[model samples]
Target: MTEPRTETVTLNGRPFFLRHWGNERLPKLLLLHGFPEFGGAWADLAPLLAHRFHCIAPDQRGYGQSWAPEAVSDYATPKLVSDMAALIGDAPFAVLGHDWGAAVAYGLAISRPDLVSRLIIMNGVHPVPFQRALAAGGAQAEASQYIHYLRAEGSEQKLARDGFAKLLAMFSANMDTGWLSGATRDAYVAAWSGPGRLRGMVNWYRASPLVVPKAGGSIKMPDLPLEKLQVRCPHLLIWGADDRALLPEATAGLEEFAADLTRVEIPGTDHWLHHQKPQEVARAILDWFPDR
Candidate 1:
């Protein structure tokens, strides 16, 4: 098994920490992690794919040792996408993202199609369909209600109280978390314990423009320009069928945006499917791009 090599690279005058697996000479694959988790979140999956590609996982803006700005506006989609664009320089690479990281990955693919050769999303949603699902006040909206709580004032304190009991509960809610124990659990806690890291992580929810309506109460859907949001690259979506937070509705009509989209659902797994079944996820990815 290949261990990750850690380093810091400056993007837009800000330090973004990165973890590298496999040889630098290999084909590049950028890995983006979601909220409350750092680049290390890819530890299990990256090594498996490292033999074929150079796996690069970044802490992103608001997590781990990356440059986490204080303002909510700093975490906006454009900035997040720009951070990634800067990191990759001029090379076109494969991009894989999970959860909030998927949002950034989609943004990158949409905004800079030339830079992304392939796109992969693990249990994540695109903004247009996700927003529609959120506004419909259905299962997805109800499941996403936690977004409001995380966006609320002093949410960081609430999540941090009692040694992050609330945060841990939220992470393990309706999902198998047997993998998140001992040293793995300690690593996550230590990352969250970083100064302003909790607030930074929560700020992703606060900064997002997607609106989640109350259950059984519908809201007007915002205008999303489909032409502008289309993903031109070959896209693959790996779903954990049991994900409660992001229901099937969240990914509805995703094919309209991704001209070439492939979806594979791994059974008996939930939102943290990557953590729970890295081998299966890696196999799915490897099978999808056998020539890579």
Candidate 2:
């Protein structure tokens, strides 16, 4: 098999970086990376699925070498969804996301179901269940306190004051071996400290106006209907049973959106399930693509 190649393309007029592996003629799978990371997060798993599919992992805006827009609204859900759609063009693809990427993928699936054929979320809650937990208070609020810190002013200064040591620490503390190497970690740190990236990354939390209120209430789109919002194409939920930020309660009602959902729980793994268990994550994705 050939080594994966890194490439760049413009999405909605913004330059984005991506890495692709596997056969061009095969079906395409788009991997969305989480906070403070890059397209390299899927480096290890992409090749495993390469023989049968074209795996494309992108460094969502604000991280890696991708374009990081200064405006907070640029990181909004609608814009992020547009960016993904623009990146993939008219191609039909399956969407796989982890952490923050999972949130973006959910919005993408909701706003433009036509672009995404299937959805796979790891270590994140479904929007409906997430909304429910937030209304219930306590755990949801506690789990989300970090957002306050992120959105607060002087965040950039604070992050920079420590010379981004905390950011680097979080990356190393959270992810597992396959997700990043020492060299990759250095690259991530550099990107975060780069000209406009840190501000762009935190702006995602700042611009997510739907989050706080939505967490405080249930899904508001009665027209679409949560139950009927199911992705008929197919869906998979791979979770790290030991996830810290998202607990089982948040996943309590995922069945509502996944008509044919396949739930796989990775024992002893944390919120960064993709990194903690890349082989298993890859296997779950492979199992979902029609034939084993």
Candidate 3:
């Protein structure tokens, strides 16, 4: 496989790192990664799509070599979405996001519809439905208990201790980690080892407005304006059915918000499906936008 070209672009007055695959002349595809991972998270999937699209993966605000702000408010969803907006400028492009990256993708699509031609989410959820599930204190809330843990003060230090054993455990819990060994594992460790990176990454949880209630407990749902949360572009959701962290409930009612939504389930995989089954994930993405 060919290596991705690395570059830096200033966004929000801070230098942000990016990894590019394929030529810039092709249709642009922005790939957003999730927690405990950076733009390099697309290493397995972007190359497969490079044949037809210029895949650009950013390390996001707090991951990899990108700007890592110390304030928790800096990781807010709107701020995160704006960073991507700055990167893309005036042209609209296709966007794909996994895990926490999906939150920014959804925000971009909703807040700046003209910036996203198409939206793709892998093992991620829309905020409205996800927040509902989380507030209900059901399966999804139980699964998302880690969010609170991550938001706790000094939690990043704890996760980084003992060679990141706690972080690794949290990442691999009830998921397939066979793909996370050798060099891949070392790379993740290195990213986490960056000064203040872990705190910056966890701040995303602290800054989130979603409320995750305790199991068997329910909280009043926030009044989310549906009009402001609509995904106007074509949307594709590729789910890893076996994911334990994000239950199906998290994605329920997604169609109500997405104008044109298509869902495809890839069984026998979990949260790391992109890593464990990149070909299938790529195929689903390519198939969704055949005419592009």
Candidate 4:
């Protein structure tokens, strides 16, 4: 694989950091990183896919070197989805997302399917099922309790202090993080330390309206038509079965939103499945979408 070029693009006058690999002439492949992660999280997967497509991963909204506005409104779903739409442009590109990035991808696919050629989700939930899981309180609500903490005032300082101790603790709480070396730790520390970056990232939680019910509490879903939110495109969901944060249950009833939904469950991994099994993850993607 060729060495990736680091570049920046202006979206709605806000600058976004990007890492590009492969030939730009090839069909585009856009990758989005999840919470507590930056575009560089695709370091391993991008290179593998670059040979087949022009792979570019952007530091979305409030992460890494992207524009990190302090207002919660800036991180709202519409704004976040627009950021992706701007990056995708007029051409249809395959979009891959994980965690919070997945939420953004789902929004884009549902609201503006023209920009998305296909959708690949890894441990990311669709709105209806995810909101259902959050409202139907149980394991998912218990797992997502941290969302409340992130929404709390002053949570930014707690996560940033001691070199992002609390943020790193969140990663450790769920899955195996034995792969994080001193150097990797240093890079994450740098990304999280960006000016107003921590506050901007946390605002994603603050701006979201999805309510996670408390223990023994049951919540209700909105009375909207599934077709309104259904992903009207080829969709592939690659799940990390052992994910403690976004449990597998969130995927229940997902077929109702994706008519052509395809699922591949890779056992024994958690939320950070790409880092743990990049090759297998890439292979799953290749099997589903092929080289196009």
Candidate 5:
């Protein structure tokens, strides 16, 4: 298939870089990428679903050529949600997010259910269960240790050193590096190498309030009503069971928050399942979407 078109549209007074596929007249699917990644993260998976859905993946707020606000507070949840809301406007579309993007997707569903028709998350977490697991602190707490490091000052420079060696290593967990061929690696380098982009991306971790407990400490769970956080839309989860970062416990009890939830697990795949098994990810997502 030919490469998707690229464009930048102003949203919330910021230029948002978007890579789009298929006919613009088709139904829309907003694909959100996580930290250390840009819109092109979906390069492999988006094409598989392009025929049925208009795949529109953005560089998000702090990645790639998109606007990079230096302040960590600027990347707060409310601001992130508003950026997406502005993008959707009155249009009805399904939302798909991976990693940090998944957080924003959940935030959108919770804050403005009317703006989202369906929610699809890959290796993403919900507030309640994730908080519970992080608070409980054991295996997951250990796996999430990197979160604290990323949140530290000057961490972005560490990730950017040696051509983003540490940042790229994040994706190498539990998956072959073959997916990140020379071309793919160069694209990511360019995205992360953007001035102020690394700071903006890392600010996501800094801006988040999720308390991942230290090795042995436990955090009390916050009281939040399901009514306020419920994902009323049909939601589908495509998980890579081998994910080392966000453990299975993170998504456990997710059903309580989503009214209609479909869980699909692909064994032998990790956090980069979309990259390792793009075809399978596409098939599962297409099957879950309305009208197939």
Candidate 6:
């Protein structure tokens, strides 16, 4: 396997970091990381896919060596989309996103379908289903209690001290010893420890651009309706059946959006499918790529 090469690129006029694996002759795969993480989230999976495709993972703004701005709006959807568009340029590549990156991927496919020929979302739901689930006010609320903690002041500092380690420990408790390696843990800590990283990450929850209704109000989807938007390209959704955060119900009606959707469920896996089942995840994506 070839070692991934890191490169510096400018997105939305701010410096960002990207790591690429495999030869330029292969199909391009753009990987997007989730909250509390950088592009390195795909480190374990990239090498596995490199044999067949060129994979590039970017450290989203405010996450690793990427530019960190003080204002919350800097993390807004428009700016984030613009940054992704700039990075995508003329390359019509496939995208895979997890968590916040998944949300961004959804927006990107909807806003600039020209750039994304395919999409793969792991452990993320459309904002519409998420909001409706939140309003349902029973199990959804219980599952989402962590969001409140994230939005609380001083949460970042607290996480920096204890929560960070706690999250890392959970991976060990839930997965095989071979799954959670020292290098992976170190990379996660390094990215999470970056200056203002946690704050910028939590800003997604605090400064939600989506119109969140009152407690009992009806839930409306985001600007793009997952149902109406015909994903005119190939789409794959890999979901962990045992995900504690986002329930299986969120994907209940996903077929409405995907004209050509292939769904795969890992019976025993959790939300961190890449970390828990790296090889499996990587292999699945490689098989899904066009002409792979």
Backbone clash numbers for all candidates listed:
0, 0, 0, 0, 0, 0
**Positional deviation of residue 2's Cα in model 5 after best superposition, in angstroms:** 3.0
**Tens-place lDDT digits, model 6, residues 167-272:** 4553344334455467776777888887898787777766665443443344544454545445667889998877777787766666767668999876668887
- lDDT tens string, model 2, 64-153? 788888888788777887889897778678888887888878777777788888888887666777766655666665666566777887
- Per-residue lDDT of candidate 5, residues 38-90 (tens digit): 99999999999889989999889999999999999999999998998999999
Candidate rank order under lDDT = 3, 1, 5, 4, 6, 2
All candidates: CA RMSD (Å): 0.9, 3.4, 0.9, 1.4, 1.2, 3.1
lDDT score of residue 270 within candidate 4: 83
> Looking at candidate 2, what is the lDDT of residue 129?
76
Worst 10 residues of 1 by lDDT: 209-218
What TM-score against the true fold does each predicted structure earn?
Answer: 0.98, 0.88, 0.98, 0.96, 0.97, 0.88
Task: After superposing candidate 5 on the true structure, give the runs of residues whose Cα lies further than 4 Å from its correct spot.
Answer: none
Q: How displaced is residue 175 in candidate 2, in Å? A: 7.8
How displaced is residue 255 in candidate 2, in Å?
1.3
> What's model 5's overall lDDT?
0.89
In candidate 2, the residue pairs with backbone N, CA or C atoms under 3 Å apart (3 or more residues apart, or in different chains) clash, namely none
Candidate 3 at 173: error in angstroms? Answer: 0.4
Candidate 3: count the clashes.
0
Q: Per-residue lDDT tens digits of candidate 3, residues 1-292?
A: 6799999989879999999999999999999999889998899999999999999999998898999999999988989999999998999999998999999999999999999999999999899999998888878888888888898999999999999999999999999999999998999999999988999999999999888887678899989898789999999999999999999999999989986999999878899999988999889988889684
Higher-lDDT candidate among 1 and 6? 1
Per-residue lDDT for 80 in model 5?
93
Tens-digit lDDT track for model 4 on 138-245? 988888988888899999999877777888999789588886767777788889888998898899899997887766676786565666898999999998898889
- Top candidate by lDDT: 3
> Clashing residue pairs, candidate 3?
none
2 against 4, candidate with superior lDDT: 4
Off by over 4 Å in 6: 166-178, 210-230
Return the lDDT, model 5, position 90. Answer: 94
What is the clash tally of candidate 6?
Answer: 0
List candidate 2 stretches off by more than 4 Å: 1-3, 169-181, 210-229
